[model samples]
Target chain A: MDTKTDLLSHHISQQFNNELEELRNNLLSMGGQVEKQVSDAIEALINADSEGAISVCEKDTDINAMELTIDEECSRILARRQPAASDLRLVLACTKASTDLERIGDEAAKIARFAISLTEQGEAPKGYIEARHIGNHVRQMVQDALNAFARFDADLALAVAKEDKSVDREYKSATRELVTYMMEDPRSITRVLNIMWVLRSLERIGDHARNIAEYVIYLVKGKDVRHIGIKRIQAEVFDQ
Target chain B: MDTKTDLLSHHISQQFNNELEELRNNLLSMGGQVEKQVSDAIEALINADSEGAISVCEKDTDINAMELTIDEECSRILARRQPAASDLRLVLACTKASTDLERIGDEAAKIARFAISLTEQGEAPKGYIEARHIGNHVRQMVQDALNAFARFDADLALAVAKEDKSVDREYKSATRELVTYMMEDPRSITRVLNIMWVLRSLERIGDHARNIAEYVIYLVKGKDVRHIGIKRIQAEVFDQ
Candidate 1:
């Protein structure tokens, strides 16, 4: 290539990388907001704090705006630069990560809404420690998944994937307890059911966070480790 | 700028478009499989068909494989072609759609699992009616979103977005009734709760489809209609 063309190509590559760094920062910021929301929503539910719930609902707009901005920036980069190969993957992954992050934000909002309703009602069932345990499990899974994505750590990503099963188990156990609670107390069933939905939503946020990790694995390693068994993923990573 | 380079560029663009078309077809086929799974899962739950539920579980492998194939194809195109502007948007949108479709398939599988368990338990309560209502609404939403995507019709996409509210409404009503059912008879609580989760899964699938429709609007109209009201989207469309 000629000198001018070479310089232009280098400039484009540098600019693209900068955009990616910006996207990464945006995703991490959004991730932080979502994690806080999940944690705060759970706290509100446990404490029955209606105002905390309202604050979570209101703060969702910030997450939503971050998502929109990331999306526009990524699109603008693509339109302007037409980056190829790994650079293109970075752009595509940013868009996917943005969507997942946005949904995570939505899940948090759902939890907050449930907390609001539960607070208005008055009481949760007695001796229901399982929901809190499950919520913590889901919340931690989300935290670890975001950490994995932020650092592009495939091992961390794999760990996050494995952790999902625990969340599933917790959810099922909570389901059983909630069913019994409803069976025993007719009046508390509505409030209890709402909590179950909130639990389910938190579980789903973990699921989406795992998705973001899978994207990270794809972006960094070009491996599609989704749907396969953990043993297989481990073997594949070792073999590579 | 040279004739040879221009010809090479044209050839690559054609190839990139072909890859995109293949990706679209693959995503549509995946969407179709997911739609069937969602419908069959509801049928299994409502009619107590264990075999149908099992098949949905088995078919998940196929859906998963299709998702992997599409992801690889998209990454390959982005790497090889370096498409820009609208072309890049199309690719990014397809990647996003692929992930959404995969999650939709996962939700359907979860529903099928619920169906299997419910069928094993014999019968569910009146909540099954609510499940049917939710299933129909969400299934239609997925169908419309895919149709909107195929046509790249922003108006149809907007309509699909509008339909999400209806699914949300139905989901809330379903929750209220399920709580009532659980309160009325603890014996029926377990079965009703399982059905409520199936409803939640379907509602999430509807949300994912709506996200896809929004991406379609972004791709076709270059407008970010997410988070904004439909009025803003309409006004922006006209302003363009």
Candidate 2:
């Protein structure tokens, strides 16, 4: 290539790199916001703190805006830079991951809404114990998934996917226990239903975390592991 | 530009157009499959067809695979074509829309699982009538959202968003009725809970449809209407 063309190419590449970095930073910030939302919302639920729950709901708009900003950045990079191979995959993964993050924010808001409702009704029930346990697990999954994305660690991502199985088990057992509790005492049915919705939201947060992990795997390995069994994902990551 | 360069540009544009068309067709086909899944699952629930529910669960794998395929195609085109402005928006919208469609499939599977559970227990209860009503509304929303996507109709997309408000109202009323039934007759708590879950899945289906409609608006008007109120969305779309 000519000197002028070579210089131009270097300049474009630098600009593209800067754009990719900005996208990553924006995504990480969004991930952090989502993690805080999940934690705060769950804490509010466990403590029956309506004030905290209200704050979580209020922050959802910021999360939504962050998603749009990251999306626009991804689109801009795709259009202007035309990044190939890994760069393209990174941008795509960022875009997809932002969607999961936004949805996670939504789930957090759902939990917060339930928390507010429960607070209005007065006093926490025993069912929140199970929710707290599951909430911790799901929150960790979200944290690890975001870390995995930040480091582009396929192994960590695969581990996150495997961790979801335990969350599912926890969710199911919790649901069953709650059902039995409700069946025994008709008076607690309404309260238990609210707790059930909170559990459902936590379970969905786990699913979104798993999705984020899958995106990490895709970004790192360029293989789609979504909808595949955990054992297969294990084999794919370990055997490599 | 020289004739050769002009011709090359035209050829590239043609190839990009063809890829976009293929992506659209693939998306439409996936939409059709998802529509079938939602319909069949709800039908199975209404008819107490365990066999149909099992089939719906089985078909989820196919829908998931289709999503990955479309995702890969979108990434490939974005890398190769670097489509700008509206074309880039279309590709991004496709990727986002496919994610919603896949989740809708997941919700359908959840409903089918409930259907299977309900079938194993006993005959259909009166609460399922409410489920059927909401299910039909959710299914119509999905159909209209997909149609809006296919035709790139921002107006139709806006309408879908507005229609979701009614679905929300229907879901709320249905849940209240179910909860009352559960409270009134504790003997039917388990069965009623199952129906409640089905209704929740149906409500989520409507949410996904709304997300798809928002994507349609974004693709057509280059505005992000997510997390915005309906009045603002109307003003944004119509005031222009």
Candidate 3:
């Protein structure tokens, strides 16, 4: 009788593991799609490729569908399995990662919107260089954040967080440049304002990347480092 | 012997209930604090009260500390009790709601930053009314979302979602007004741009409220209605 009970427990554990494995794979797939969207959206704006921007917008449907599916799966696991400890944390992380990925999709859609406006304006001024520079920095930050999440690498996540400062500095530079362009010629203000919105979107994308990094810290250290100073988080997580 | 075992189970159940009660109260407290911060921040902007914004900033430290404490408590309950079904959902929802509150705090801080900038600009144009309109709308949506969460009212949550569209429409109006302001006098572009940022921030606050509402629907119906149209969600939850 004891042996039968043990066997039942083992079977249940195995099924839970399989379900968790499936969830992890699906979340990674969704992450990959959003990462691609961010880069494609940046490229479209820089190259003035309206087609690429439109394509990213079209692909958003798939990202949305995946987010919904993962959310449902996570809810099912919670309802049916009553996961605890590390297993529960994994499911919780998936829910959060799904929300972040969906927001990244929204950011990409925002970039695409800017691309449409830029195309309508025919051509942007020379200061477009500054905007692309900031975009590239933001895109790289997002890529590194996603990679850190995939590997559960705390150091990589820290690197992503540290890069956010530089992204902000670049954003400030881009803002100044755009404002100067608007001030130079009033006609340029319309196009420049659109570009500024794009810069704000990229800057926000960087902020989201920082948010993902904070989650990675939580996942690894079981600490809530968010809203606390980063210096304090590093001391608690690393120096300890 | 059976009676003794039942007594032990009852004691354990009571302990679990106490933990869940603490979690619920902590979430409500955090919700109340965050709700106040958002409203106060907008009020500071409208009244050009830097002191009010500063007060909000100072209170953020307390909000952040509360979030950390709640996160730790939830983690402990999950680790020790291994609650199932509705209990598990309650803990998970508490964690997610805590996160939303933290982000709401961030948005309030952002609104304060905009207030500082607007104050420095000395006087915004006659179009400040548009920003005020959207700010009021977003604030109401947030308040309504929190009310829905406290009562677990799916119907109230759906109403919050519907109200989000009106906030979006207000945002569009603010944009049109600001853009026209900038076009009329190029010198006013900087001042107008700052107001636009405030409008954008308020719009984002509405988005976060929508997120909270989505979680409310999920909590009530045990369905992942996120990414689906809000109308469908209302029908599915209330059409019975």
DockQ for every model comes to 0.58, 0.73, 0.46
Tens digit of per-residue lDDT, candidate 3, span A132-221: 787778777777877776666667878888888888898887798788778778877778888888888888888888888877677665
Residues A135-199, model 2: lDDT tens digits? 99999999999998877788899989989999999999999998988889888888999999999
lDDT of 1 by residue, B1-240 (tens): 342232123444576656767777888888888889889888988889889889999998998898888878877776667666556666777777888888888888999998988888885666788888888888898888888777777778888888888888988887877676676777787777778778889888888888888878877776778899767876765675
Error of 2 at A113 (Å): 1.0
TM-score of the second chain in each model?
Answer: 0.91, 0.94, 0.89
Q: What does the lDDT read for residue A157 in candidate 2? A: 94
As for candidate 3, its clashing pairs are none
Query: Model 2, stretches more than 4 Å misplaced?
Result: A1-12, B1-12
lDDT of each: 0.77, 0.88, 0.78
Task: Label model 1 with its docking quality class.
Answer: medium
Error of 2 at A102 (Å): 0.8
lDDT for each residue of candidate 2 in B43-154, tens digit (9 for 90 to 100): 9999999999999999999999999999989988887787887778888899999999999999999999999999998967657888888989989999999998887788
Clashing pairs in 2: none
lDDT of 1 by residue, A180-239 (tens): 776777677777777777877877877887777777676666677788877877765555
Model 1 stretches with alpha carbons more than 4 Å out: A1-14, A126-128, B1-13, B237-240
Q: Which candidate is the best by DockQ?
A: 2
Best by TM-score: 2
